[model samples]
Target: MNRRCITGTLGPGLLVLSLASGAVVRAEPVFSPAATDSCVSAAYASSPGLSGHGVLDCIGRAAAACMMTPDGDTTVGMMVCLDGELGYWNARLTAAFAERLADAEAQDAELRTLGSAAASIEESLRAMQQAWLSFRDASCLYEQAQWMGGTGGGPATLACHLHETARQALKLEGWWAQ
Candidate 1:
């Protein structure tokens, strides 16, 4: 049995959660985990056929590719790969928000409350997205600081950004689903 805790490319993610290791170690420091963002929105933006889970699976192939590639072996390279994937998801989110706004303008003209135009919902979404952007940035900054100046800080910080952005993308996808 290969006693080496960190072996060859098991999959996309840094830490392999599988038959090899019964427990996914919390501090194992994944080198090349699965890509966080689902590349689905690029194709099915603002559509209801796909769910958040679908998005997660949609990127599975790319994640596996990343695992095989040289970049998957290093923390820095993995960060770059994740950042690239995040871009795709972010684009989908933007498209989703725009699609929602367009729908609102065309049919749902009812006021949100009493005299407040339903357009306020658009404003609310815009505000919420901006706030989330700020929060993700700030929180990652804190995470980097906490993980020390460098050793693990860069990877952790990038991972935080990737995870949070992907999460937000999923939320936007959920909105798109609606």
Candidate 2:
């Protein structure tokens, strides 16, 4: 097998383009779910193409998976599938936080506590992450309720979750400078 990585700039910002098939597919930042071509991240166990796999790819797949459910397919089943993908992204976010925290601690000899005053950076990060989860849940609940009595409620809630989780994951990746 032959594998190669191609790196370039997309409109001045860094971009990683995947192998082609008549279209240019670029991986988006974490939490975005690349909105380009099909064949999302192979991590989703869905797309056969591993071209632009990333956090963004995972989320994109969640969106597609839910939206592409067959005509007779249940929305609840789609939501369940998306929830599993969200779980994977949450784990990635946690890993990013841990990696960044370790790097920060290693740079300062006196910073053995991982943070200064009040609480450890780890605790702070965990708290902030918890807050994000709470907010995502509450907001999605509202989205669903707003669409109650309509066919859009379930999808509205699922989309809210997928987008929020992906957005947070993107933030965590930014923190991981490495």
Candidate 3:
């Protein structure tokens, strides 16, 4: 077991790693999902019919708030905050994907019933989603690579993940609407 202490703005984030299984555990501060969700909700409320990248304005509010905290001021803390936001976006992405897939399947069924030989929308959606995932991973990896193994790489990668996830989530969420 190896333990490393990364200092934050107000305190320290303890990072623990186990050599045998290649597992890592970290005690770091995470942003509040309620706060982030509230911010996003407010953005939508303020801008009636808000969709697409317009929702991005609310993306970093909670992370910025978390970053202001004593436990979130350090690199590890920032990563945790970014991870929290990424998780939020991931949830949204999952829901949006499910909704879109279901809609596509329904549409395909309708087209089949009508004897219209249209292409499979569900298959196209699945392919696009897979490609997006690959693109997001590769793009984030490139962003991290730009840091050259520096400590900044971790946060950069996380930020990239957050950005990509949020973008995809919003895009998928508004797909049928647009």
Tens digit of lDDT per residue, candidate 1, span 37-93?
334544356445654355554543444456457646466555555555556556767
Q: Answer with 2 or 3, whichever has the higher lDDT.
A: 3
Worst 10 residues of 1 by lDDT: 25-34
Q: 1 or 3: which has the higher TM-score?
A: 3
Better of 1 and 3 by lDDT: 3
- The segments of candidate 1 whose C-alpha lies over 4 angstroms from its true place after superposition are 1-64, 104-119, 175-178
lDDT of each: 0.59, 0.57, 0.81
Determine which window of 10 residues in candidate 3 has minimal summed lDDT.
4-13
Write model 2 residue lDDT over 1-178, tens digit each, in one string: 5655565657632344545433354433222223322333334344234222353544546445544544213454445545555665667667877876776555443466556444455566668878988999999999999986677787678777867876676566662223
Candidate rank order under TM-score: 3, 1, 2
Q: Over the stretch 56-117, how does candidate 3's per-residue lDDT look in tens digits?
A: 77776777788877668778789889888888899999999999999999999999999998
Residue 100 in model 1: lDDT: 65
What is the overall TM-score of model 1 with all chains considered together?
A: 0.57
